[model samples]
Target: MGSGSAKTYRLAFNGTAGQYFGIWATNVALTILTLGIWSAWAKVRTKRYFLGNTTLD
Candidate 1:
């Protein structure tokens, strides 16, 4: 491949069910406690979690 050529990276998900469930459970609890006001924050948190666990290599 030429130096100027586009490179490809593999996308991998390293998040485990147990780890995700913990985050989800916390988000759910907080959302309920805040009367759904925490849903937006929960969404951001979930997205960040997923992104953080994903790898590009």
Candidate 2:
């Protein structure tokens, strides 16, 4: 890197509270109904929502 205008990396979170709540609620319900058996899938979906919304700018 030179002393000139250096490159910069920015990270952003674009997830809204409502969107996250919806996903979280769905996961909770499914997990409960399945007697915690669906918890793994629910956790995956929850993680995916956050990961997908995270952006690099």
Q: Show where candidate 2 strays beyond 4 Å.
A: 1-6
Choose the strongest candidate by lDDT.
Answer: 1
Tens digits of per-residue lDDT, candidate 1, 1-57, equal: 567968799999999999899989999999999999999999999999999999999
Local distance difference test, candidate 2: 0.91
Misplaced by over 4 Å in model 1 are 1-7
TM-score of each: 0.79, 0.81
State the C-alpha lDDT per candidate: 0.95, 0.91
Per-candidate count of clashing residue pairs (backbone under 3 Å): 0, 0
TM-score, cand. 1: 0.79
Model 2, 3-54: lDDT tens per residue? 7997799999999999999988988998899899989998899899989999
lDDT, candidate 1, residue 36? 100
Number of the top TM-score candidate: 2
